[model samples]
Target: MTLSSMSETGTCTDIINLRYQDGSVGSPSKPQKFNYQDFGQLKQTYLRKGRLFVDSTFPPDYKSLGNLSDLPRSVRSRVEWLRPSDILKAQNVKGEPSFFVESASRFDFAQGKVGNCWFLAAIASLTFQKDLMVQVVPTEQDFEDYAGIFHFRFWRFGKWVDVVIDDYLPTFQRELLSVSAKTRNEFWVPLLEKAYAKVCGSYSDMNAGLPSEAFKDFSGGVHMTYKLKEVHDRNHDEVLWGQLTRATKCKSMICSGTAQKGDTIVNTVADSGIVDAHAYSITAVAEVHDGSSNVRLVRVMNPWGEKEWNGKWSDESSWWNRVSSEDKAKCVKRDDGEFWMELEDFCQHFQILTICCENPNFIDGDVITQWKVMIYDGEWVAGRTAGGSLSNSTFSTNPQFRITVTEIDTEEKEDKNVLLSLMQIPSQRYRNDERLRPIGITVFETPAGRIENSFFRRNSPMKRIQLYGYERDLIEQHSLKPGEYVVVPSIMKAYAPGKFVLSVYTKTETSIEPHHEGEDDDDDEDHLILPTPPKPVVPAEKSSVYDIFKSYADQNGELSAWQLRKLLNETIAKGSSDLFDWSACRTMISVVDADRMGRMTFKEFSTLWSKFEDFKKIFNRSNVSKTGTLTYDELKSAVQAADIELDDNMVWLQYSLLQGDSSISLVDFLTLMLRMDNMAKKFKDKSSDGFITMDWNEFAADFMFI
Candidate 1:
């Protein structure tokens, strides 16, 4: 689809356009659709129908796949296609499989052979608070129902998605292959893990990732990472303790990991029982007595279920002797893979600590300041480009977001907080390096009216942060005044393809929306020709192509995109049979029709035609590779041959128009040449007044048809 058609409305399309046919967006304030079949509703429907829930996504196909007893662990290990009921029929208790045994807890999640201890540690932390786990793995479906289908909801990006899978799971030697529960009866852990794997493409994709990412997905919370060395060096233990205490009070999911020395495995077990470069779930942040003084302590849980921290605050440490009996009962429990360590010791050993703080008033329903979240999915490709950060002289080529903060949080003493997060899709399968793209986001304050073109980069930023490596997802918190702003997310390197979800969390009444699709800024709409003043006659020196275009021109020297479509159909097919067609005509018009006026003046048409001829000359010179066209890599030389300098955004737009193709055709090259001229002229007109600006009406006319 053309850029104009994608963004013509300048806002979210109707339910039909959004494909939200069955339900609303599901915001906290939006009306809850009683008929919507989420995990709970679907289970209740099956229960009322007196039938079991059989997930079609993954079905019981034991007879076709061979008996589970005969299947090898490596057989079809790549595909997660076995029902828990088929294999665990003997292990199951009475009926079907239970998603949870009694209630889900830290003891429920155990790390299997897969090196996804980070994920398991996050899961263990998830079980510390009932409200948090329920929000994650909703306790809606039960094993007694005998339904083979089980579903779990995860806070994906900003919305909750119900991922349904049959009780089938990946296994090695018929045992769970990935993350599993400590007990076979408690299937929520493995089932949830399989569903997540399904969402992430396959079980292998989850082999390695940051636990903070899992925490963010599970809790729908904002996560931030603090370096342990920085905290200790700064002597901010009390400050860190306060932050942890507040997070704990709000029921946040927290995890810490030790740093690696050299290339050693982070999960290496140490002689003292503390694993190096390993992830541990922080169970509690409390103060306990240590002989003469009240020592601050933080409790941690190991997913291995045995490697206890034999430190000063270990389960049998002499420090426990100073603790009062009542305090000991509340803090220490049996050897459930949990131990309390001095906060000082915990900080000294761990290198990084991450906390996924729940949105304000989410758990207790204290609606003093309601928080609403929105998510947008976007991507970048090699030939298809997204912009870099705003700090660069170049405007960002990535997806753009326009957010208007109409109301700021005034009740709290601190300034209003806007939580912006970008989570990159895991790229482990493709890269041996295993490190994901280093990513970050920048927000700038723009005019309140229509969005100016990306080339209009004069707008000053409200806040900007540098890029960070993929050890964690990119996150930023901004406290700002209520106004209009734009957010751009990009990788440190340009033109790298990375799929990501951009999530924005703010107080209710604030709105955030995607401004561009990293291709073109033109809003999508039907071809609507606006009335313009009569154009002067075109110079006679123009090529015969002008005469061909004149056949569809009006008395006012105007011709519509439809007219251009007819001309292209009649002329292009006669020469290069596969070169241009009705579809190409639409793209051609989308390029030159910058104002989206649909029709071009005779002067405008002549200018575009001459530019097209010039592009042919440049393309002919740049085809030294003997290819008929120039690949995106060779585009700079082609532009140099044409004696033009395309701005950052225009260059990105041209490559995006190529749509992942390595090369650009004669017609596509000409389209880019003319679009750049049109945008440059408009931008020049706006900048002539010292600042590039747009009023509501001007913006609507320039970008949106509305």
Candidate 2:
């Protein structure tokens, strides 16, 4: 059969406007550009359950540092806290949570599965000073807890801050979430105040999620301040940083932390500093996870800064062992915070903070010795760990997520072996709702950048931000930190295969850490990268060469030589990347046959051109560098010293010769190729089988002078 008997894609209007054959201008259907920010304002007419899901692995316990050989397995196994270093390491790799952080000092004790606020509080205090994280204990050996703490005094608007603690978190009687978490979520009173020193704004304002709010709208806000991020060697680039605080006087920003089951250290840095999206403090010596007894350990903060080791003690391993000999407990591996990777999977799994504190300001007497943990509130990008299955908001009706928790048995000798205690088995789609969920992996790439958030449900808002467009329906406010970004639809769709106007908006600001009260302002501005350049405007690509020919054929109700040449030349000059791209263009053509059966329409030219504009743009006169058209010599000459001999015109001719009735586009292009293959040869060798493929009107096509 001829090429006209294939499937139908979209309907065509005229030479300028093309829509789906069904009359509606088709939208750019797949390879979507999702507006996570104003999703609420978007037209909710979704092809329900049509998207795939995303998932990843969490940090592993076996990869944790330190040993717990002396402690019981139950306590060691059940005890777990989120580490700042690990979170920062993960962010560095996957580059997720792209929201830029303030250069201010910050801290937060991550409540693991057990929700031990007490332990998180103790760790929070340790973040105040490098030694505090070290002095605090994680083991039950000498004074009970073996975890240390660090502190760094934060100055926001003004006034000194104080927050101290060493206790366990309260648990829910019936449940520990949502309504169950109202008390813990509430600000001040018994829970927030008793443990905290003095909340930032006042005892009444801890709920504002300071540093966050302060940075959002305070005198020395996050926008102008400067920070020093030297977690690595090359920490000196002026362009990377955001501007310094426009406000003259700097205020202190501090977080409060409760205590842990057993931790030491009186004071540390007053408040840990922020780096990228993380906060950190120094620890005296650390005892990570070990299958045996609770190992004495030091805690460290991720100020988005470096792991600092001053070498106070001569023998590195004398005071505390970086690596434990007795403890065989499973340790949580440090890796990228945003993406998931198996803990035991080589170097990608775990990472230790490298010490790099050389600033004279970071002296023994200057370090903030006491700190409290704080949690900022805003548009949070939420994700879950690897799941065998996934359900909706609840897990009772249909357990969509089936996770396996490995209980570290430190009491027994067998637990010390690097064996997985419990592994969650991957569950096939069973529940009806589970199948509709965005559960597997859905990577959204737009003009702004890339958003790789994993959605649990079909319509769950994994990405929440300000609203836009369409009156009340449009979510207008955007919660973007300086250096953060967003995607917006630019133009109204006309020839657009789809109906949407999206544009990318990147914040034109930097992220710099604030300065100490007594410290001088003379310092190098590093870490904060300048805002990305504004996006360039791109024109919508017209139809392809073949599609144009097809359109002319259908309009005139017959195929003519002139129509064929025009289509062929158009395809070569505009649609394809040179005449040769006709083969590639044909490959594009081969996909859409246009009819009900296996046939193609003259309009495939338009369809193909619109789809592959970026690729086609490479062949334009602009890239060719010639004034109006590509000259014959320019075509034959090396397109650069790269690739092979030129065949721009031949490619154009071969595309016209392609018979819609029989054979493939490739075969047809090859036939023309075989006809003039030898044209490019320096001196035709009689014995050579290749034919010369040069243009007959070389002189006429040279100057582009019509």
Candidate 3:
């Protein structure tokens, strides 16, 4: 089949060859299916094209610009607009193709829902290759008038590509096409068919797909430089133009075009006195006159409707970069959409945040003398200057393209002033001491000099996570990437330094039940446990390696009767392992039994002397020595073997032995053990029916240090 558009007829394949540098001659991707409400939302936005109401007090996201004065003058004043050479250098710094645009933008689209920013961006690129916009026309095949048909072709890369479109821009009233039952298919059906028949000629027609998807069908010919090919069909969106400007690699800075359906109009950035500012757009400039005005003057309707400079060529503004401080006067404020400025100044300063949106009041009656005004973002290599300095610290200077700040909390102790540190964890490991690399936020408790758990930024921000106050359910914890963080909760909790657990969620109580053997775990195969391993029976007698040590201790110091019994068990089960190996002590068999006390806790265990064993070797070997008790020197040597760091436990143990160097005598040791046994039994108090006491092994674990 053959198709013709703009005086060119060709096969489907022939049309595919029309690709341009930044324009795609290709068909776009198919649009995703929109539900009724989603589609309605889009339509409603178009209907509500009212003037902007910028609220400067709010954050950037919520603020609307009052006028040029309310714009981010700080940014605009400091960062000089990039020269063509600068743009070219910044071009593809990240290795991506960029159409340098600081040289072209004339007008910007204000905050509107129109997706025309992209169209404007494309227009910017088009100017580089010469009259690209006027080259395309919509015609029909096997028919005339081209009423419902469109044979549109645009130059992309270096070629012209044809696309047949049938779908009318979606309208507000679906009922517009619902002309009763009699004319049901008459209006919309003919409109759609005629639209399609014209574009593709006798072949397939209608560009009914996602922007990216349509491009894919057109392939290399039409999408030579548009690079819509890189964006996935599913993620392609009409709002992509704004995001593109922010994206470093999409470096095409300048853009211009008429507003369309899906564009967003924002307040003026030019007014903000900041480059890359936001503003509103009112109407389009169809034609113009010449004389005193060097550049054309397009009439634009401001959202604030505040009349700044309303005249041809905007004699009030510093247009052509030629307005002297003395010549230019302050702008007057008004409350209507009517505002006039030179074409270049109007376009270069404010960027239309969105693509073109429909001007609900555009006059077809009398060609109103107006400009298809645009609001575009300004260029900035550094943050806007406030006084003589940049706003966000020294200029980034391209050290890195992205910067993220995070706050970390430190544990609180029950005593001094404490501070919190916010550090950016580098992906790779290296010592970072640069003051700029990290900063401190000293946390102060409410109503006083007290402190609390470390917060993201220790300082009190205007809007914070809201904890320890009326809104204290503080469940919105952040999931930080794994790395080192810093915090000093309060003087009491001084500094928080440790590897914290990765938490999934926080609740008042866990409430989940522990798994019990033989229980069917909801029929999920997880209930299947491996066969129970037989319990090992350690020998009751026959002194092992530990007995030898016990004998030495006996000769050295009297072994308490309880210690003797532990010696027997240690000899049989553990051989000569140090009694204080972290793992062994933690296993519930080390301390209490050796101390002859069936109960133990960190405080109680503090009084006892301990011997250490190589913690690492303790696990490598089997039973025996798994829970042997050692004396002062022996303990020190054993701990060294384990590669364990000496902690408070080791010191306390040594202190006990030095305090009493009495050698063990069987009789005296037996008496001490007997008393310990009685004390253990009494403390357990078996009389409390359901309340159970932990066994000897558990007692030992109560004081185990990991």
Report lDDT (CA) for all predictions. Answer: 0.61, 0.23, 0.25
Candidate 3, residue 92: Cα displacement in angstroms equals 51
Q: Is candidate 1 or candidate 2 better by lDDT?
A: 1
Which candidate's lDDT is highest? 1
lDDT of 3 by residue, 11-54 (tens): 11111111122232122321111110122233334336532221
Q: Mind giving the per-residue lDDT tens digits that candidate 1 earns over 1-706?
A: 0001101111211111121233445332222221122555666687788876665433434322222222355564443445666547634435555677777777776677656678888888777656656666767666666555676666654455667666766554556655666666568888787667655545545666678878877766667788987997899887787667656655567788887667856567787778877788887767766567778888888887768888787887877767777666654556777887887888888898887765643222233555666666566533223444454433344566788888665775555557777877543322122457678777777764334445346555665335556644676777767887877777766544466767777766677776633334353221111212223445667647667776666422456556676665566434653355555555555455433434565665666666776777777888788666677656767876665667557666677667435677766666666555555566777785656776653454443311
Give the CA lDDT, 0 to 100, for residue 169 in model 1.
Answer: 66
Error of 2 at 530 (Å): 11
RMSD of each: 15.7, 29.2, 30.7
Per lDDT, what order, best first?
1, 3, 2
Candidate 1 residue 645 Cα shift, in angstroms, is: 30
Instruction: Estimate the TM-score of every prediction.
Output: 0.60, 0.18, 0.19
lDDT of 2 by residue, 382-411 (tens): 111111122322211111111111232344
Q: How many residue pairs of model 1 clash at the backbone?
A: 16
Q: Which of 2 and 3 is ahead in lDDT?
A: 3
